[model samples]
Target: MAMVCEGLVVDLRKLEELSCLEGRGMASHYYPPCPEADRTFGLIDHTDPGILTVLVQDNIGGLQVKSLRDECWVDVKPIPGALVVNVGDLL
Candidate 1:
């Protein structure tokens, strides 16, 4: 995982002073089954403030990514043993 993260940082070569970069924090979320699923959100839509966001999702699918081209919320189907890497606003 460290190697993967390092490679990602290196790939952003345009960013100046890469050596000064560090991991800000780590987080994990658990969304339990809700009766009013349609009326509630486990996490509200927002842009990540950091450089990158690594999301590990379980089999319960609810993740959505807003499309820049269509302006629609698209479901992100969960795949076993897959990691979702998102480029944050800071990038």
Candidate 2:
């Protein structure tokens, strides 16, 4: 995850004293099919609250990323055997 924050001010490179290994966790989510897909959202638009997030998308992808270049929420089309690395607020 620290690699995701490379060149940033809060780069977490030297974490020998931070007990980072003991403070780690993981999660999984499942979203059932929504009949009204346009009107509903499994998760609302939000920023990552952690240092970094490694996301593995399935074939039925619905991921989106806020594009800084265009200043828009762009749909992230998933590719097979790929991972999305999200840099978060905590850096």
On lDDT, the candidate that comes out on top is 1
What local lDDT score does residue 32 receive in model 2, on the 0 to 100 scale? 61
Question: How high is each candidate's TM-score?
Answer: 0.67, 0.69
Which pairs of residues have clashing backbones in candidate 2? none
After superposing candidate 2, which stretches have Cα over 4 Å from the reference?
1-13, 18-22
lDDT of 1: 0.73
| C-alpha RMSD by candidate, in order | 3.9, 3.4
**Model 1 lDDT per residue over 9-64, tens place:** 76443454554255567787766777887898456778888777888777777779
lDDT of 2 by residue, 18-67 (tens): 54445776777767667788897556779987666888877777888889
Query: What are the lDDT figures for the candidates, one per model?
Result: 0.73, 0.70
